[model samples]
Target: MPDSRDRKARKRDLTPEQREKRQARRREKRHASPEVRFILDNNTRVPVDLRPYSLNWDAARIGDPSYYVIGLAKGGSTLMHELVRSLCEAAGRTYIDVPAALFDQGVEPARAVLDPDWLRSRDGSVFGGFRWLHPWMDNLALHERRKIVMVRDPRDILTSLYFSHAYSHVAPETGRLADTFDEQRTQARAQSIDDYVAGPVSLRVFRNYCHLLALTRMPDFRSYRYEDVIFEKRQWIRDLAADLDIRCPEDRLDAIADAHDRQPEAEDASNHVRQVAPGDHVRKLKPETIDLLNRRFAPVLAEFGYGTAS
Candidate 1:
């Protein structure tokens, strides 16, 4: 009659022999190529190159013309990017997608579009900067810059991240970023949703969620929910356009909203775009896992108004 949390604790208290037996069963379920998992778990593999995201920050100007769409990973930042880009087009401005790895201190700004000064030089163009962190806005700033920060229910964010990593971790043909981190081995070795929630990726995401919540409190940034963006694209666009001083004609804003109004796709068992509906974690996560996350991220949930964790 023990609940899942109690059962999980009981398993952890098993004797040595029983522990070995449990591990043996886990090995039987794992489908990874042996060598890669060994290297990843043991830290023997070469590190994946993430240098492509080097953020060589430059000096800020007083009147630099730029706008930023900032959000956590899998938190509708991509959709925010598209919405901002569409606004730029409607306003006769150029949309510049900033690279994720722009923090590298030494590299020169090779691309003209990435240079804030170069962007300033071009008339009728706006820098549509998309990044996760707030400090990224410091160096690229001008007096006229605007920032739109997006947030999502952390439960949905966690669920989406799990599926994304789940696909990336085990499926080699999918060519996912998870493969880069684990060499495509970890998920095949995953035992359950409980294990996945406690995995390295989820822990990192938790840290980021905490960090992002703190950053969101800073002044001069407009925040919106992922739900609002999904259910109210037109009003969201209008609000964003107004903040950025972009005079998006009513028809153009409607057209952009209509273009993005396609319902969440249904065939995405991979959960790609299929069910962007919120609260996916309710179905995908076990009771114990939810309790664990609730305890760990209680502050973040309360900070963002997702309701206080008990």
Candidate 2:
């Protein structure tokens, strides 16, 4: 049998009739299965069957004490995660850092069987961050938990993403995933930033923003804009702390804000913190590219109080 990559390549070469036939066969096979599947916010199906066991085991033990910081990959999630970790430490709470490996491999099995134990092992209030929403999270019952979703201007996010994927973001020394990242880096280097943003990367970023927006409808969920976190550091920290019910002191808030206030003297493509300034897209992207992104991201811009006006 051909590998998945080979199958995909061959599928792309199929005629319209052949594609329809393949899709019909897939539908039949899906209907034949008794296993349950979840559709993620990104419109991808979770391949794992979620039947027989619930993802929410040990719910009473876990209870609503966990805090989750979820957002776009390059959208200040690391900064927020560190700040939350600081707050957890101050309160003597356990900070559970979910391994990126779980996400990379598949969160379905972990969520169904392992997450509760992991969350329960930590004492007191537990808080951690996830890079983005995953299909398994849909079954985790977040409404009772304190969840914050961070969003950046999709334009700035694209600018940051281009640099991160092409240069700054680190990959493993060797692996299939590392090879994929290498390919992406090469492609990103070859294309203009505008072309790179206009490609599939834009869709992924926009979908993340949409998912983040959707979470705002949950009772205990809040959304924070990257611009506010950067420009109005103190006020933003206080607001975030209040939302998460953390009694952060003025001095501590100042310390946290000061610690993360990064302003690099120069744009270093090799550095993870390439540049912290907002609206880098205005200077880097073309007029037409900016206009297109502004239009495409109008809903997100308006919802997050980001001006859509050129």
Candidate 3:
């Protein structure tokens, strides 16, 4: 019983015919080309310059029980990874290597979460974007509600770092143990947990840790020590797993130790390794060099309990 003017007003709104036509148009657009589809999907971006970088991760791929290893340079993370894998293997659970997984981890969520935006903001302003990456990098967000933590030791860390960088003789992959190992790391290969002492890698790793601290306000952020891992393996691992609300079998840790014994003799083959071994650094380090390391890495070492002992 509406008048002509009212009916005209109603007609101006979306009507049955209008709705049908609009829906038809949307249906057509759904089948459109990739380029057009992208334009439609990414309309929220402001007029920012499109750099070679981006933070376009999906943050939803990794499973709930997943973990991230935020190890600093010279930390015993490589051994940690091997140990974790051995444990996970014994439990019949899978532990993906974070260091190497960033490069094409053969999974859909890995793809989405490793996008442009997240890639860009990993560390300093220089490496922000899809172009930059950390070896063995794993997005905490991708873990689909899993746990992420860092483990390290204080004295051994400084000792290993000193040898890792300015060794008048230490040369890893990049050069003779100089600035970085990244130049030689394969873009196709995932991160390596064993490359703990490869230059200033921890400098970058710490930046990532800072980012995580800012993003997640959770109280249970984790940091473990290599000593505890070596001495109180079961208690610590079990505690870590419990913090993450899961059951970690101690037998897996034992298996990891056994597996570690089976690896290359490279660990025991070199003097550099020997110098950095537990108790050796304290005995061998020149007083000045020890002071220098303690000074430069004081903050990190303190967090890991270095100052009180050596």
Candidate 4:
């Protein structure tokens, strides 16, 4: 059989423009709703006062989340997702895959494929994020209610991402696995040394984390931490349940064990797993490299309790 990567190449690798086309179709579908149409075209011209009409009856009537879990990759976001999934299952509450649309096709898929009425308030609905999640959360008129939002300390997130990137895209399956934290730097140096020594993983992680942090600035959001999830699963779930105004089940929250046994290892599924090991990158990254990452990602690193670089 063909390798899994090869399968993904055909099934998932869509170009940016192709994704835009998909989103256009999804938006067209959303626009077809009478409520959406009223809000868009005639909201300004309405004779009655606008504030009451802006209310979200759906969120008021049936409680199902359409919120985003915005956080850096490998920042325990995936495990948090599993925990939330488990909570919903335990309570027998429907997990609605937010019918909201997506634009980009990479971390986020286009909204075009989602039906305007395609809400799955049943159990175990898998919702795509990094696209649909952002927009859905931002639209105040279209309330997602609330869901879990988590962030790990940047040091831990940096470590996990570094190693994961190395194995997933750079390292080989054969004899030698080069954790070249000095990726592309050793060769391109003498001219653009700073550029060469710069870590790609650090750059991506910092930027995405900063973006995720910005979401809490929006109203109706609840923030969390990796430490809280790891150390206080029950409290974490309770807090999340309160924000979402949903009942969290006792059986759903599980203790943090060597969860890798129950799930895939970071390196094995780092690129694609729903959950990844936090801070595994520390082993692969050298001390100097960590310092370099600290400097490069100081903004987000500081925000996540890593403190300012001296």
- Top lDDT hit: 2
Name the candidate, 3 or 4, with the larger TM-score value: 4
> For residues 1-310, could you state the per-residue lDDT of candidate 1 as single tens digits?
8899999999889999999888655543331111111122223332222213212112222234455566666777667777777776667554544343221221212221232333333223334444344332344543344557788877777677666665632232322232353642456246465676656656766777765665566556778888767888888889888877779679999899888776755736455464667677777887777888887777777877775332
Give the alpha carbon lDDT tens digit for every residue of 1-310 in model 4. Answer: 9999997786577788887787766654433232321111222311112122222222222223454444445666555655554444455443332322111111122112222242322112323233123333333322343444677766666555433444443333221123232442243333232333254645655566665666655567666777655655656666655554456444434332223224454445335452444454354455666677677777766665655432
What is the descending TM-score order? 2, 1, 4, 3
Clashing residue pairs in candidate 2 (N, C-alpha, C atoms within 3 angstroms):
none
Instruction: Estimate TM-scores for all models.
Output: 0.63, 0.71, 0.48, 0.51
The lDDT of model 3 is 0.40
Best by TM-score: 2
The local distance difference test score of model 2 is 0.68
Error (Å) of candidate 4 at residue 135 is: 8.1
Worst 10 residues of 2 by lDDT: 51-60
For model 2, the stretches where C-alpha displacement exceeds 4 angstroms are: 1-64, 99-125
Using alpha carbons, what is the TM-score of model 3? 0.48
lDDT per model vs. reference: 0.57, 0.68, 0.40, 0.45
**Model 4 lDDT at residue 139:** 38
Ranking by lDDT: 2, 1, 4, 3
Off by over 4 Å in 4: 1-66, 97-147, 166-197, 248-282, 308-310
Q: Weakest 10 consecutive residues, lDDT, candidate 3?
A: 33-42
Error of 4 at 148 (Å): 2.8
